[model samples]
Target: MFSSGHLSFKGRGEKWNSTDDGESIATEISSVTKLEVLELCGNSLGVDASLPIAEAMKKHPELKKALWSDLFTSRLNTEIPLILKTLCNSMIVSGTRLTVLDLSDNAIGPQAIGALEEFLSGPTCFALKELYLNNCGLGSAGINVAECLIKCHEAALRHNTIFDLQVFVAGRNRLENRGAKALAKAFKTLGTLVEVKMYQNGVKQEGISALAEAFEDCPNLKVLDLNDNTFGRRGAMQMARVVGKLTKLQVLNFGDCLCRRKGSESIVMNLAMNCSAIQELRLNGNEIDVETAQKIVQMCKSLPKITILDLQQNCYGRNWSILVSHFQKPFVDFGAESDDDGSRDGDTSEEESDKSDED
Candidate 1:
């Protein structure tokens, strides 16, 4: 079903569990002389099928992008690690320098970290620029990803190559404070990063502070999305300190981050003073009051390039209309008014509402 150097079975809903299925795909892979991109999403791949497909991967040294998300649906937890390891091994052996590797929506937990570690630190990732592992359920094991990336950076340096990773997305992984701190170390080291998105990771003030410090080193960062995380006053202030440094920032999403009144003020003030290239600014569900929202509106007026400003689900109450009128911008998304007393029940309900909105 594949032609030219590209093969894609995306959203096919095929359940490939047998070795025969693997061999068929392997045969097709071997037939492609200049294979560069392989997309295998929306299909369930078992260990049997993965083995042959992985073997075939080695034959195509030109392979650069492996869009392998949602490939292990209905698979045993034990089988996923083996399949992941097998595929990684083949890619490593192929002597190919990958540019984009996406393994999102797979639910590959901590057990799969070993395979990821080996693959990421190997020669295959020397030229990798974009890595996506969204909704992988990595939990605390997420730290391994950062550690392995550091190893990969070191390996690239030793080989006289630059590991200029540009984009990293790992949202909904529950990589709390410890995992965040570890990743901060890696991000600081890989200063070539352009975008970093780690939303819904349960990262608190400590983790946020660490990441803020790390972000100071990445001057090229354009997109920073830490949505649905908890960023209290301390965390928001820490982030505020670095917002002035990221002059190239374009999209910044901190929605549902629980940055209270003081924190919101600090961040808004910094964004107004700094970040002139900012295009989209999301501060929704941050418990911002009318007074702070006024400042945000004023900030938006100063940012000429800003296109989208999300101030939804905050403590705007009836004052939402006033704030909206002041904004004057058509791109502002001020979803629903909140309590007039500015009393936020808790972060749990707010985060749940945010998730439902996304769905």
Candidate 2:
């Protein structure tokens, strides 16, 4: 029975069943009109309780964030689609300005995909910036999610605020290369996307290659997390090419992505040269040797600023001192020295141009 700007009953799991007490509480919650954020995650609020909450949320014209994750179990099969439809429709209504929505860990299968797709494709679109749909039982059928995002990108175009729609997180949905290709298309459409996280989605080289191409267009993209996926040597080469294109990129997480000798080399080669704005770079557990690690660290030393350069779990055992020296050396020292190196002039000028454009 809560109705403030933020409603949170996260861990009260299965305490209120389909009994009268649950109905009473739901009725009270429905009447609350000041709710802007609703968080019912980690609760076993069955269909009985969820319906009333959805109805209440519909009334909030200014609802911005809703987190109803982890509401699915083995027995609750039939109600999942209905719940998804109701919530999405609520956001679609006129005067509603929902932005951040998290429906992760809800076991949402193909049954509820249509409801979401319809809502995004509808005339009345929201200014949704962040969307999280991780571990939703999507399996290989996550292409629909990418389609919905495409529609959202189209909607944002109508408003001329495409860059406002930034973060799109769909991690652990079992989306393979097909899904990645679909999202790559969407990224091309929405060129202003900042952070895109598709970690642990079984995306391999082809999918990552598509994403790498997308990076060439999205110059404003800052953070990209593809951790725990399979981006082998070929994918790494593509990634290297794309990394050179993103000027504003700051954080890149490719940890445990199965990059071997050539792949690792390709990534290090471009990143050390082109990525001047990079702050954090993760390449742990990629089977890189000591020589490659030293090269990467040495190359990264050219950057004017850096916070973290993780190379743990690689083969950089005896030559770990190279990493220490990288941290010890002043980043400004190479910036001045690299100007004298005629070979690096083009890269330096391009980086400067990108930074000037951002200013």
lDDT of each: 0.86, 0.70
- lDDT tens readout by residue for model 2, 1-359: 36456777786675444645446655665666677777777766555555555565666777777777886654366777766776677666536766787888888767667767877654434477777888887765578877777786677667775535588788888888888898898888777689989999888878888999987888889999999888876778788888877878898889878675567777867876787889888887676665666667678877666677766566444444554466444321212221221221223343343233223
The candidate that wins on lDDT is: 1
Q: Any runs in candidate 1 off by more than 4 Å, and if so which?
A: 1-4, 338-359
Give the clashing residue pairs of candidate 2, or none: none
* Model 2 poorest 10 in a row by lDDT: 332-341
What digit string (tens of lDDT, one per residue) describes model 1 on residues 34-130? 9999999989999988889999898888998999999999998888999999999888788988999999999788877776788898789989999
Residue 63 alpha-carbon offset, candidate 2, angstroms: 0.5
TM-scores for all candidates: the values are: 0.92, 0.82
Cα RMSD (Å) between model 1 and the true structure? 4.5
